[model samples]
Target: MTGTILTEDAGDGVRIVTLNRPHRLNAIVPELLDDLNHALEAADRDPAIRAIVLTGAGRAFCSGDDLKDFGTQAADEPGTRAYIERIQDVTRNLVLGDTPIIGAIRGWAVGGGLEWVINCDFAIAAEGTRFFFPEIAWGVFVTGGVSELLPRLVGLQRARELIMLGERFDAAQAREWGLVYKVVPDATLRDEALNLARRIAALPVGPVRDLRRILARRDALAPAMAAETDATVRGFLDPATAARIGAFK
Candidate 1:
């Protein structure tokens, strides 16, 4: 367990990784991302840990990036690239890593938060959980391999509408759109997620891990993640992005 990321052994080879910035609605900041990457790496390397439930500490799973602090990280090109890369690394660890991660999504999962939701092996959203990508409106590009994953999850047309329009969708709609594996009562979200993880952990680890690896197809993601990084960095460095994000603030 760390200040920004909390790790709890849920027994039965399941680990619960909770985003710990509840006061900020678990908003993304550099420190939080760094801690999250390290925590995820540790869990993945541990042989005893068979499944992980990824969630947030408070009202929202993640309210996306801390807008007030976002501009400074992207003040220059190199800085922008590095910051975006760090964000992408979380997705890499979640999707390409050996351990399976199930998202216990609650409340708002906006922008990059939504990207991480998509990155999960599968997600279980709580009732009333809201999701959307506001990057386009803010003149920034979507990251976390959403370009490659979302189109495949939903159809190309639906992906375009969600990304381009930046409209919010509820948990029920997300399930209908195939974004979430299931939706549970908000009260039992974490318990349900942990139960699901326990079920996965009880399975033969070798076959389960093999299935995750085969299905993840790490080889195909290199180009997609690279393209996402390049595009997102460019968006962050754009003058229009500064104006748009500034106005939002």
Candidate 2:
């Protein structure tokens, strides 16, 4: 399938979904979300596609939500809220899809970008790639399922540190923290990721899909609970405690 936000192709039972918005760091916009959902649904429906790889063009994998698209508007309000919900749904579909996803992260994966990585079944990052969740500093909370996914991947305390401090982690640090499965040199990242995808694609479909479903179901609940906790804390913070505290003079 071809679209502005995504480019997709199937080969040897592997469907590779490339995030196409290099200018925006492949940030999640409405159209991008729609296209991604469509690509994923197509892969899930296709009997031949046994594995999926999600990657971005240009230097960065994804920088986060399209702040340019959202502009300066607050996301908690009704109009923006609906948009956020749709974005979340897109994320949910990616995680819950039958075909397991492997993220080939090259450069920066921040905010919503990190959420995308967290949702994936496996992630491989380039050695110098950076990861962070900066929404707390933006006077908002993570709407892309980070709260739920982070803890499960890296444990509670590490997730809290990343979210609360908005600290950035390098690829090596991320691997140490259990966020990424492997980290390779920048030049070999894509080849490594593709090789991994091919390996997964060669597996038997019945056992592969069953194993994916078992893990996905268990993994799904953590994000949901994390979303609830994040919403509760975010609601109490309103404009956000971190942002408000910074205004003190």
Candidate 3:
């Protein structure tokens, strides 16, 4: 019962999860978030599936939250809080879910969309892909363990600059910053990602899953997720931030 995302089995313990809302550039909404949460967890729990590939359906991987819906959502603080909780739920799975998740990114990966790319176990991006963290500029705060994870990926100074400046950076820079593990030509993005996922899936499941767990900062993730939830709710409800979101609409 997939909704905003399409799921396909790639065989040999690999599953491809596609974000389906091409018209909206697969922007984040409660439905999409919930779908991702359910889909990702299901893949992780399926014993035959060893790896998951997450990609977007159209031009952009994701353009972040659907600002059109955000303006109305922020008007109701409880609605805003619940929406972010769903977003964090997806993030939680990305961070702790057993199946290795690889992100195949192309086009715009902005705001919360960029957070997904960051949290993915190993991200492969098209050369033309662009990413940015727009929370600061939008008068909102970071979520998805972004504050801790970004710094771990790109150093505290660089993460601070990227978060505070909210400027767009290309795939090459992202690769150099260690946020992305690989960068391929636009025409081959999906193929390359699929190949990588298949290769990872071919490895012995126990060792692979164990290695992932051993590498993960399990102790850090929970606190970071909790902090993100609190900050996300606070930012969404802040009058000034709501005003900014309102003005954008």
Candidate 4:
């Protein structure tokens, strides 16, 4: 399935789903977000598809939300809150879904994009991949359970540096933080990620799926995500956030 995003069976129960907006660095627009959720849900529903490899088309895995289109979104607080919920649902699906997902991160993974990396079951990044959590820099709070989940991965201090201070980190640093499972040659990111996904898909689904579910800890994530979403809605409506966004524009 190919539309705003791309999805194709990569054989042996491994599906390859690419974020297809290369011209825009695969930024999250309404179309891309909706398509991504539909693709992930469809893959999970298909019994034949046991695992998924998510990557980008050209450079970035996803830069972030497309700020270019932000001005056109519904201006009211209620309308904006609903849109935020839709974005959070993508992360919810990724966290709770039975099928495991492998992220093939290449270039920039910043802002909302970095949230995906934190939520993926496994992430294989290219040596050249650059990561940053600049939501604070852009005057917005993170929608995903990044506040709660990120600290669990990299300790509270570093999570604050990354998300609160808005620092940029390299793949080597990301590997040290345990966010990336493997850092390979930049040229082979796709092949390496696909190979891992194929290996995962070849394993028996029952134990593999069960292990993933236990690790996901959806019971905790559900409420943490809800809290984050509610906080994000408030940030989205803040006059300071609006001023910063206007300046960015």
Error of 3 at 59 (Å): 0.3
lDDT of 4: 0.86
- Total backbone collisions for each predicted model: 0, 1, 0, 0
lDDT of 1 by residue, 1-249 (tens): 359999999999999999999998899999999999999999999999999999999899999889989769778998889998999999989988889899999999998899999999889999999999998888788889898889989999999999999989999999999999999999999889998999998998888878888877677777888998898888888888888878978
Model 1, runs deviating above 4 Å: none
Off by over 4 Å in 3: none
Runs of candidate 2 with Cα error greater than 4 angstroms are 72-76, 218-249
Where is model 4 more than 4 Å wrong at Cα? none
> What is the lDDT for 6 in model 4?
88
The alpha-carbon lDDT assigned to residue 190 of candidate 2 equals 73
TM-score of every candidate: 0.97, 0.85, 0.95, 0.96
As a TM-score, model 1 comes out at 0.97
RMSD of each: 1.1, 3.7, 1.4, 1.4
lDDT of 3 by residue, 1-249 (tens): 457989999887899999989999999887888888999989988999988999999999999988888666676767878788888888878877889999999999998899999889899999999999888887787788888789888898899899999878999999999999999998998888889999998988888778778666778877887887777777777788867877877
Q: Which candidate is the best by TM-score?
A: 1
> Per-residue lDDT tens digits of candidate 2, residues 134-249?
77776677765666667877889988899989998899998898888999998998788778988998988778778867766656665574565446345424755434534541
lDDT of 3 at 43: 91
- On the 0 to 100 scale, the lDDT of residue 123 in model 4 is 98
Candidates sorted by lDDT, best first: 1, 3, 4, 2
Each model's lDDT: 0.91, 0.76, 0.87, 0.86
